[model samples]
Target: MERTRNSWKCPIFGDLNDLKDNVLPTYGDVMRFYEWTRHRLKYERERNKEPTYKEIEAIVVARLIEIWAKSSIPTVEPKRMKVMLQTYHLKCKNLLKSNPRIPKNTLEGFRLGSKALFDIAACKCQEFLKCACPKNKKIPARERGFITDQRTARQMVIGALDVVTTTKITKTLKRKSIRENSKSKRLKKPKHVRKS
Candidate 1:
């Protein structure tokens, strides 16, 4: 009799090793994780106050590690996870910086930032899960008719984020458009004929 070797291991759950080959994480798991994190952060804020960036970063990193470990991929390394988290953090920060109308101290700004982070995480998780599985193999959930495609998953994340931050995004876009339109109008006006 030949023994089969399992290549995948859950970093957070040692007991999951036995089932790693048989099971894989689903898109639903990613969504649920985001929802859970958002609610937990909200509750914590209500009880105490706004958590510091370090506190939020710690929570985000821990949750990501747990989620990735639960997936079919083998061994979510700390370095890779931290790099991913840092990239998303920078993206969210840049988004805020670009949208000057959205005051960072306001409740709306905080909510938008949280939503953006969740969106980034969800998109990354979907891409990672889709590509992690071998081409010849069907995802565990896909075989059961869960029917999650990469494009659809990405679009869903983007749409959800858009819905949440539409006002802020649109306002900034409108301002930019108006500025551009005025600049174009000025350029269109022929320079007054300079007669010596």
Candidate 2:
């Protein structure tokens, strides 16, 4: 009997090599190809009228499913997935516009393809138990203070030191004057006050 291609040398009985080699293309390769095609489409679209948003969305979702099927990454966040799919769809729409031979019927096909892909991505994401990220999450607000700059911080410290020194000198001077005034009052008092 003819020996089938030794799909693997490992003692394992499973046939994953065949699946990798024959059944589906690698995810990276497919995504790269898609990106190149998208670039071409973009260049073409710029010279022509752009596709509608709905049409663009459909194209992207469909392309995303194709990418997801082969990707090693099992789960994709819903928003990121949508963004990825949208980018591809817009690119495809641009490509289709440039091609003169593809019929109106093909546009309908693209729409259907997009919807099917969107549904598939949604189902897969749900199965994988991914999180729904908050829309409001953002970069933290900047701190408000005089300490933002090292130079400013140093200047502020110097200013504080000057205020402290001025306050101490004023207090010392005030105490000395009060003591001198009290001594003068005692010296001016009559000799009858000496008994006290």
Candidate 3:
């Protein structure tokens, strides 16, 4: 995520490897541009033109971003999670051990990232925040439950329109550079170092 290939604009992430350690995107984006781009890029790369890239390159890119988003979690509501863990401690009377799926010690770091993301998502789903997600202002309390659910579903859909997209420039570029340096280097170890 850069404004341009290489510009004065600061990049969203400092390093490519940091992507996995960062947030995860949700699943089932109906309008992911990558799905289309995957094929198109493959076609172009075969011709040796850089309009796109495909095949193994495309697979790697997908692995780099969506894999984490789809496979694992990126921290969830943490300030909330802390409040939850603390409440757990109080309720269970186990201050030292509360069986948190995520421990409280890492809460500081989790708070920093999740606060921003949670606020963004929460703000959108709020009673009214002026986001792309529709606002159901002044609905009856009795109907608010379903209305809220509907709004949330709409929010996810609207947010996902052409949303699942990213360029793994850093990784591929680094790989190409490494290839230039040493041809036989495998990025990862084989399934078995020794076969039976």
lDDT of each: 0.41, 0.40, 0.33
- For residue 115, give model 1's deviation from the true position in Å: 13
lDDT tens per residue, model 2, 1-196: 1113333221111221211221222222233334343334445567544445555444544555554344222334546756765565455647455656757676556544432222222222221224343322211122112122211222221121346755875899899999999999999988765564
Evaluated at residue 100, the lDDT of candidate 2 is 69
Per residue, candidate 1 scores C-alpha lDDT tens digits across 61-170 of: 56655543343223335555556556655654564466656554563544433332222222233443455544433344422221233223322211112354557758
lDDT of 1: 0.41
Give the better candidate number (1 or 3) by lDDT: 1
Give candidate 3's error at residue 152 in angstroms: 3.9
Please tell me which predicted candidate would have the highest lDDT against the true structure: 1
Clashing pairs in 2: 60-85, 60-89
* Residue 182 in model 2: lDDT: 100
- Candidate 2's error at 81, in angstroms? 2.3
Order candidates by lDDT, high to low.
Answer: 1, 2, 3
Residue 10 in candidate 1 has what lDDT?
Answer: 18
In candidate 3 the C-alpha lDDT for residue 158 amounts to 17
